[model samples]
Target: MRVTELSFEGFRNLHPGRWNPDGGVNILYGDNAQGKTNLLEACWLFTGGRSFRGAKDSELVQFGADYAKLGMTFEAGGREQEATITIRQRRSVTLNGVSLPSSAKLAGTFCGVVFSPAHLSLIKDGPEGRRRFIDSAYCQLKPAYVGALTDYQKALTQRNAFLKQSKELGRCDSELLDLWDHTLAASAARLTAARQRYIHRLQPIAAEIYNGLSSGREDFAIGWDSPIAEAILPEMAAQWLDALRQARRADLAVGFSTAGPHREDLTVTIQGQAAKAYGSQGQQRSAVLALKLAEATLLQEVTGEKPVAFLDDVMSELDTSRQDYILNHIEGWQVFITCCEPSTALKNTAAKVFSVKQGVINE
Candidate 1:
């Protein structure tokens, strides 16, 4: 997917303006905190109406403004499309002039993979960040996964509340607990199966990309950690139910449901060593870049359209070799990169460079 046009009003420090981007590499260069990332965030909003920076909707509004408005026109799957989002007390989304009931419906309409400074910590950070990476990519490829994830979260929340109440009251209702257990187990089974399949498919792709990034000098592997081991859904559900039953007493004592997909993790290892603990800073960054590229490839493989790439100043953290590898690899996809300086190497490539200053964009 390539964004053809992007417009924003009352967003961060940005003045109301529209950007017409080239289908190839489009570079936005500016000093720090001058709305360069803000422009990329606007493009991200078209994907699923959620900020890749994890900003709250209200926080995206400009100072003294009541609301923020964003519009994007993109080409995906051989068709031109438009999406708009308005954020006030609540957020609203529209596609092709028709109002959408929820932003969840926007999935797959436009998809993108983002790389930012925050992503550099994926290896050093906890498992939650890695898990989020998987879920975010999977949700875009399979929208039904969103429903399953939501249902599982709801059931898990309700189950935890019941556990807390039972612990407080010193008594538990077996029937009520059974209801939640069944729901949780069923949903957990589905989630585990989907995650395992995704990881299995992603491992080789990521490893190959990392190999190229490292010039074939290192070995990389990814593994999924889960409580359920059975390959079949029914068997997995049964295992989950059994595990939950066995852990009920401990869970009650702790006032939470402790055995579920929410507690699972993804492991990245280099040459059989835990990447999180043993990998160097450069290694970790390479792993993350590989993962991001693999995610874009997976999205294209499943969706038949390349997702736009949003690089938020991550190039500054990489060495010259890695930077060149990335710029060379992302040839067919539309890329929006934010950087402080225009690299001399980029001059020979087909790049549309723009300048950002004080919320204004100039070609």
Candidate 2:
């Protein structure tokens, strides 16, 4: 898929900006914080209806403004499509003038994969960040996985509230808690299975990329760490429900449910060592890049369309070999890459270049 044209109104520092991008590499060069990332974020919002920088809908609006809007025209499978997003206190998003019932429904239709400086923390941060990384990848390839995760999170919230109330009452609402557990476990099991399947598909691709980047010096592995493993969906649901019951007293004392997919993690290793703890800074960056490229390939396999890539000043972090790998490997893909200066490396690669200065993009 390729974004042909993008327009922004009252979005961040960009004011009524519009551009038609080339299918190949598109470079946006500027000093720090000069609306370069803003343009990419606008594209991302059009695709997925959320701020990649972790901003809420209200925060996407320009200062002193109440709303923000992003519109994009793109091509997928030789057909043109239009997507638009409007941000106020709540975000309203649509595709081809048709309203989607929820963000989960909107996720994979015109999806894009992004790699930014902040993603370096994926390997070292808490489990929540890693979980989000997996969820984002899954959402881009499997819309049903996104819906399952939404239902799982909702069930978790309801279950937690019931557990808190039961603990406060000093008597067990065992029946209600059981009901919540059943629902939570059912949803959680499906989510866990989806996550595990994604990781399984990603493993070989990531390993190959990591090996190439590391010059065969390191071997990489990715694993899913969920409790309900090697079981059918119904059986896994029953197993988790029983586990919750077994942990009831401990959960009550802690005032939370502690034995579900929420406690799971994704572990990455290099040469039999934990990537987060033992790998060097360079190694961590390479692993993150490999993980992202693997995600893009998996999305392509699942959707039969090459997803757009947003690279936020990530080229400077890699050495010559890794940089060349990225620029050369992603041949038939749409890339929006931010740089401080237009490098000779990009001059030969970029299909379009836009100069960004003080919130303005000059085409």
Q: Write the per-residue lDDT of candidate 2 for residues 1-363, one digit (tens) a residue.
A: 899999888898996878888888999999998988888888887666466787776777999987988888998767998878877777777888998765546566777878887888898788888888898788766656767988998998998888788789888777878888889889988988888888989999999988888777889999988777657889888878888889888988878888888889999999989998998988898889899999998878877889899998887767777776788768889999998986667777756998898888887
- Candidate 2 segments exceeding 4 Å error: 98-105, 173-180
lDDT of 1 by residue, 262-355 (tens): 9899899998999999998889888988999998988788878888899988677677767777888888889999999977665556899999
Error of 1 at 143 (Å): 1.5
Model 1 earns a TM-score of 0.93
Each model's lDDT: 0.88, 0.83
List, in order, the clash count of every candidate structure.
Answer: 1, 0
lDDT of 1 at 242: 94
- RMSD to true structure for each model, in Å: 1.9, 2.5
